[model samples]
Target: MTARTARQRLRDDAGSAVVEFPLVAVLIILIALTLIQCALVVHTRNTLTDAAVQAAHTASLEGNEPEDGATRGAQLVHDRFGEDYAVEVDADEKGEGVVRVRITATFPLIGLIGPSGTLHVDGHAIDEETW
Candidate 1:
């Protein structure tokens, strides 16, 4: 190839990246935002599970009332996450020596625009026996 033709080819390819950046940039930003939203959903679920476990442990003690577990779990959710996330807390006695705690809250996807009444987390523990 001639030197002039080679130089022209180089110049055309060099500006290709400039034209491509805007298109690729939008796709990259979209992927990043999707990943962040997934992380948020996982974090919220883990937090809710932790709160339920703590409440179940508290209620399974020898002397604590079942309702206390729900209250404690609600407080934990409120303190750790926020009042908006501490939506509903329930404690149930499953059998002779088992207690279960369930927590329901709004799952955050995009800054408070998530599905309602769908997210639920539960914790179970055996009750302690006292003399």
Candidate 2:
């Protein structure tokens, strides 16, 4: 190619990086945000599940009541996540000497806030009285 033609092509391509950068950067940023949100949601779910299980275990300790388990679970959630998460815990006997704890809460959709009643988790333990 002629030197003039090459220079003209270079001119046409000049500043393309500046224009393309924001576009690609925006896409990358969006992907990163989505991944981060997914991680947060997973973490929240795991935390809730852990709390429920612990509550069930506590309540299964012979003399403890279902309400006690529910309260413990709620406190655990509140302590870890603070009051930002609207969590509800319920515990009851689930037949055959088993205790079940159920946790319902809002699933984080955006930055730890989301529609209510979007998450549900259950934990079960054998009642110590049966042992």
Candidate 3:
């Protein structure tokens, strides 16, 4: 090919880089969004677990407002997540001073294929000092 024709070909090929740049940018953006969503799910689960454990610790002790404390735990879970959260606190009846909190929510991301539609997390906290 003539040198002029070869230079023209190179110019045309250089434009392809600009076109490909946006495609790569779009893919990177999508991947970043997915990563952010995954991180948010993990953070939500951790927050729910911590709130449940805190609530259980408060409610497990024998107080004048045992039910209220338990309700507070549930409320904390609700406030952090929303209506799709469930918190369960079991107070030991044997007076063992042990409390267990179970928190669960719907896994919207992973639920599309997995049978475990629910995201469950358990936390244990001791309330031996809450008077």
Per-prediction TM-score: 0.81, 0.86, 0.65
Model 3, stretches more than 4 Å misplaced? 1-12, 64-70, 84-96, 110-116, 127-131
In angstroms, give how far residue 83 of model 1 lies from its true place. 1.9
- C-alpha lDDT (0 to 100) for residue 79 of candidate 3: 83
**Best model number under TM-score:** 2
lDDT of 1 by residue, 8-33 (tens): 88777667788899999999999998
Candidate 1 has what TM-score?
Answer: 0.81
lDDT of each: 0.85, 0.90, 0.63
Residue runs of model 1 more than 4 Å from their true location after superposition: 1-14, 111-117
lDDT of 2 by residue, 8-125 (tens): 9887877899999999999999999999988988998899999999999999998999999999999999999888667889999977999999999887678655553379999999
Q: Which residue pairs does candidate 3 place in steric collision? A: none
Estimate the overall C-alpha local distance difference test score of candidate 2: 0.90
